[model samples]
Target chain A: MLEGLLVDLVPYGKAFQDLDHRWMNSEASFWSSGGERHFMSEAMVAARHAQWAEERERTGGGSGVGFGVQTKDGKPLGYFGINWLAPAHRLAMLGAKIGEPEYWGGGYGTDALLLLLDYTFDWLDVRKAWLMTTSMNARVMRQMEKVGFRLEVRQRQSALADGVWYDWLAYGLLRDEWAGRATLVEQLGLRERAAALGSGAK
Target chain B: MIEGTLVDLVPFEDDFATYLETWMNEEAWFRAHLWERREPHTEHDVKKFIERMEKDERGALIGFQAKSGDPIGALIFDHEWPRVRKAEARFFAGDSRYEGCDEVLDALLMLVRYCFETRNLHRLDAVALPFDEAKLDHLRRAGFVHEGTLRRHIRWDGDYVDMEMFGLLESEWPGYAAKVAELGLQPSGLEPKPKPEKKDEKKDGTG
Candidate 1:
């Protein structure tokens, strides 16, 4: 269902060094927020490892982006992931930890979520996708909504960061949306699906 | 809180007859519907009236038993305002044993909420008679506003009487539901909120 260049997954613990500079930029806390203070040390890292591993053990999820995100020239910018989801539900929650604050507002989130959602719904056959973000992170929420997620619900006093609870916003999107594919199809001089559907309409 | 185990309108025929008798005599507008201008001759007539409600083109029962549980009130969907998705309501405790009671008012409020929030209808309206002073007071207490009066709206006895209109909007249903739920007397079968997810996407994806 999707035609594009495939992403190269960086090997586990292979010192994806180019990606390391971005990682030390510590996008995890930049996105997860509160730096190392909120969730501390190797214990926190072990917990992260266990949480994802247990989920994978239960649901058989693939390693998100195989380790890290890399640009065409091999410059690593962010790490992306897809939470395994069932076909009928059709949506896999997605997130990216981009280390570079310089790259924060520069379309990195949109491009990565598009690429992840593109893979989840098309290659993975996801029909609907949902994700959550906090009201504190209005920037990320806007990036999510720009990619076609509409607010479905909001939970109050749910985010317990820095010993305080913040309101969390949840959003959802459907597969029929993905303007990039239509733009690409147009760019590549392909027949519009409307032409194919014309006969069905009759 | 007018609640008891719900009984179908058939066995509760006396309740229906009592409801009809008071309605016919008390409101000049209802007198015209009774062929005898008195009570139904038998339980068969009350059953026939309820059965006739099923044949109504609206395609669903008009009222439900709530608060007092013997079908004392209703939240009929799509009774009028075809384009807007609206309903009309009228209710009474009916039995001479229960006149002047406010239990049916609680029942009507429950029914109004079921029609608006649960059924997703935009509007609800009630038509009352100008001389029907106390019922109009009940409607206002239930959060409905008098929209206007319809002069010569229904022929009563030998003459038409002015009819009063009351209306409510769906936007007002939630606060009303909150107020009603506080009474611990709910319209049967209304769910509270979103069901608990088997696994709530945990905060920080660490559920």
Candidate 2:
């Protein structure tokens, strides 16, 4: 498990897989889909997980890697991972979700993202990390900026959500640009939370 | 086959496959066309590629031939269709002579028309490498808006290069068509031209 101040990137065990349906169908799904709300059956989620596992095995995890985000007490908050990786270019597209609504705006996703980036740049040896989100997602837009990712592209009116058209924004961060987790945690004012969580674990 | 003034969108055949084998081995042509790492493809690999294109349900690969019936290049449209109305358009000119020419734009206009009109797609997306100035010009002339650039996204030769993204919506097509029309590029008359079977029959009879 990859450790973080607020969350740890854990393996997707049976328990986490059991909540896949709920998380995918929840309000978080809207953000994940870039504004499209859709329902997914347990069977469908199972099939998707199976496909991801098969793909990981086939590519020897060179393509992508996913992880379950959990708290110190071992409570799963959501999931995050690199959606795609281009080894030749040393670049990866990242994705994450704090499925539990109570965790929203609480920095859980931020900590998880920082942890994921650590894994991506340090372990994976990727040069750049990027992701795409809809313009309507203000939280993500703000988080990406706070995390030091540059808004590289804006595809205007590319996504339609709830009868309204929103631009699809792509954000990219280079390895050298990332101020490591400790600095970022301090920069985002998450040091207190990190401290509190660190003390609580003792 | 969708016929235009200078080029026709033909189905994938052995002749086009042969042309692709030659183009795939050309370093400049292959690098300009795709982001995949440069590696020589064998005849067997080319055959497998054609088979994959034929079997792919979510994409269409069509070759464009000059009025002289010479296979110049191919265009590909990939999408999930009804599930996701947006499609990605990729095209390359195997014959350098047609690069950024009227014939290339003609083929693009035909493709845009087919995607928005016949296929009823909502949007079309395309990408071009940084050094592909001719392709960038063609995309702009074909009415694709420059969306954004992904920095150092593509591996070219041994170094990384930027990838430019372009998109066009269905609602924007009419305006673009009119603009191109004023420039004297006719996007009309996309009816499939009937093939001259006599030529094929004579060839088969003689050979």
Candidate 3:
């Protein structure tokens, strides 16, 4: 579990299923421009939930962890997690989506991201985290940069979304780069937790 | 088999496992070129790898000497994106003599022609470490444009190394092909262009 100022990231559970299904089905969710906006059948959503739930039980705290991003009052907002976790190389891929349209543009998303990065870098001992988004997503691109991710590549015309060709932007953040921004990271209220982890945490 | 002047790229066969094992087991080459850990090589391991590649439907070929028929290198096309008609290429030269020679270029040209002209791929991508100037130069000479840097992308010898990404689009091949021919790098048997005669003139009245 990871607690933040506005959100808490918890392991996948039965409680997150409804929100997950809605998020996956909604056209306004984060994956809208990626051509996955169509509503999935209830059975398909349930099956997906079951698969992820089993995965959480197996590797949640070990290799990879999927979290349900919720409010302090336990109001579910979305889901996020690190997939393709390569602990051997201290690397992982970041994936997240805030399904609740009401929470759009709210600081909750950024807070959730900060909390996730804190866990990934400090506790998970991961040295690198990367994410990819289509060039059309200016908002997410700006948010990623604001949180210290560096633009690594603009894979030209890689994604064809909505009959339009869009470049896929790959962004990566290294542990040392994250460590150097101590003052900024501290402002996220993760300093105490990160310090408690100590140097050997890596 | 795609035949070139110096080498022919034959579809990888089960019988070539011994040659591949010998190539991969070269400690110096693997240390300098590859990112993964060097493991003990055996015929069984090579056989399993061949089977896996076959099962995955990967494009793999063994470059053999046209004269001696000895395996000189391997060319692999991986990370296929059928929807986008693109793939990543990995080329390893087993013979050190071919490292900085025209034979390497011949093999590369053949592969590029096959990929873009025959297979009709939209793009091909390759990567090299930042310090691998030789390979980077080879990529440029073969008409691959620098894409971007993958920062601290791979662990090499216990330290992270930045990888330089390069890409070649099929649309750019005609221009590159023209440049190669104009530079006389094109293989023999293709009719060479007649060289323009130099006009000699007196600059300071000394003919």
Best by lDDT: 2
The TM-score of candidate 3 is: 0.78
**Model 3 alpha-carbon drift over 4 Å, by segment:** A17-22, A25-63, A179-202, B27-38, B58-68, B175-183, B186-207
Q: How would you encode candidate 2's per-residue C-alpha lDDT over B109-173 as one tens digit per residue?
A: 77887788788888898888877888888888878999888988767778777889899888878
Judge candidate 1 at residue B99 and give its lDDT: 32
Q: Docking quality tier of candidate 1? A: incorrect
Q: B47-118 in candidate 3: lDDT tens per residue?
A: 787777777754654454443465566777776776667777777666654565555666676777778887
Residue pairs of candidate 2 with colliding backbone atoms: none
**Docking band of candidate 2:** medium
lDDT by residue for model 3 over A5-44, one digit each (tens)?
Answer: 5667897677877666677777555353354345678899
TM-score of each: 0.40, 0.90, 0.78
lDDT of 1 by residue, A89-193 (tens): 233666556665675664445545655676676677766666667777878887766666676545443344555546556666656655554454344332333
Clash count for each candidate, listed in order shown = 10, 0, 0
